[model samples]
Target: MHSPDSLYQQLQKIGTSPALTVYGEDRIELSGKVLANHIAKIANFLVDEVELEPGSRVVLDLPLHWKTFAWALAALVAGGNVVVGREKIADAEPGTVVVTSRPHGIELDSGDTVVALPLGSLALSWAGELDPGVYDGAADVMSFPDSLLFSGLGDESNASFYANAVPHVPQGRIGLVSPSVIEAISVGYSTLSSGNSLVIVGATSTADSIFATEHAESFTPPVRI
Candidate 1:
């Protein structure tokens, strides 16, 4: 496994390449690679500095941004747990992983004193100093020959592309599939955030399908690439 510092090195490498525009009416372009770095740094802080134990659950209550992505990566790298929740934060879990999104520019509902790691906290120091080039980016890890990580790229035919299309799952891997796109995206972020070194697994159990069907949840269906 790569050292924690390696994560930062990877971030410096990617700088800021867009990830999610963050879900909103007026979306701001964010960087995925930057998010990865920020997330890794937090993980380093929690593990090396705070000394959080493996599998320790830390609840997140922040808005969607590159920083959240960083936190997820940090949690995963730290080998801790994360939980996700909606706008209203709830009672945090003790042992397992927990993560969630809370409003930014304002206080959160949890009444919890959770602060984002690294850049989030660092930004506080430079709140005014920033040039307004002030968005956090997701960590950019491509399946670089040197780097083991890879994001399924936009085009497989591009030789320089780090990733190919999200490949078709072999029948054997279908058991790990998620029933819907939301689940897959959530699962994807979970993997990136958790840094558990486990692949972003897609859980599509019978119970899961039932829940999706009952709730009318739909996964991101395969579309023409």
Candidate 2:
């Protein structure tokens, strides 16, 4: 078994297999190689375009979807700390970078950079007019090269950082039933760290079907709020 010290290191070992398969109103599939490219693009955008420094906090206010996964992975690869929640930008500290699906008409606090994600599989640009100062995630990411060389941070340091974020590690093919953004991120990252795949179900009723069809090792049903 290959024991990778960090989630990013594990992700680097995924190679070309299917890493994430999303089932919902839209069925999206991302292979490890393609996912890595997407992640690298986002990471480059954060580091080069936004000038995000190491240890900077990244506030994720997006849905439980592929875009969110890519954004989180990108942030981690860029050496930024990820804070997953549904909180508004006003609640975040100054200079914090916030990635969100909805940025239209929302007033952002000064010093905070907002990246607008369109959430489409191959969307090169946002559908509607974006507010001034709001960066288009897809557009900005496209400008960066896919091949990214990350260094400076060692394996032990990356391991320690990701270890605190992911407490419950998962192995093999895992399924989630209508999970929230934070839950999905945590569980998905854990699964990746263990060299496993994840199947995200959009509805609770389809949990059994997904499990049977996908041959999931474990299934997490939805919790009532």
Candidate 3:
């Protein structure tokens, strides 16, 4: 019954049920506890390994996938500014932290940190050799603890990281599709705030079948026209 106002609060509202489900080449479902563990591990990796400073820019140069959402939440929870967009990705500063599925496409500069996530649902590590400096996101987070603690927390001033104008999502499992990563995150924020589980249909999957199987109500972004 708690209405979460911030990303951290929304994350804490996750219950024992399945929180996120992705229908793709392999159907992936993550319960509330498992999703929290993923976020904690990623947050620990960002803070402990990458040494992400408060208010630092963490660019998510990935598509609208479950892991992408997880990384975004983790960055915010770790006191970093979550940046999403190709323009932001291209103009990332030297010390910015980048998470992407296509690691090779990104050009790294001095002080920049990049973590590559595997496309395979079951992958524990990057299948091939990663560039010398890049971190394999799937492989590195496993060793971290499921809970996290931090000090001297900074305020989230960036408006991009918070939901804007998203409709209230009903409390239940719902299928969501959005035009952009930001919009997806907005809907996701609303979903989590309302204590609803989200089911994202992958490009390769049929929405009808996935929603039917998940018993999720289809939630399409309202047309502006």
lDDT of 3 at 31: 77
Candidate 3 per-residue lDDT over residues 1-225, each given as its tens digit: 222124444455675688888765567888777777777888888889999987789988888777888887777668787888656877887689988888886786889998998866678999898988899999998798877756334354253435554555566778864446776666766676566778887554478777888898987767321
Clashes of 3: 0
lDDT tens string, model 1, 1-225?
Answer: 233334434444545644333222232433546555445555555544444566555555544444554555455456555544443234543333233222245332332234422334334332332222222221211111222232221111111110112333221111123323223334333322223111122233453453343332223324422
Worst 10 residues of 1 by lDDT: 154-163
RMSD to the hidden true structure, all candidates:
13.8, 3.4, 3.3
Q: Which window of ten consecutive residues has the lowest lDDT sum in model 2?
A: 153-162
Candidate topping lDDT: 3
Q: What ranking of all candidate models by TM-score puts the best one first? A: 2, 3, 1
Native-to-model Cα distance after best TM-score fit, residue 182 in candidate 3, in Å: 2.2
Q: Output the TM-score of candidate 3.
A: 0.83
Q: Supply the TM-score for candidate 1.
A: 0.40
Model 1 ranges with Cα > 4 A deviation: 1-16, 23-26, 63-65, 86-187, 190-225
**TM-score against native, each model:** 0.40, 0.85, 0.83
What lDDT does the true structure give each of the candidates? Answer: 0.36, 0.72, 0.73
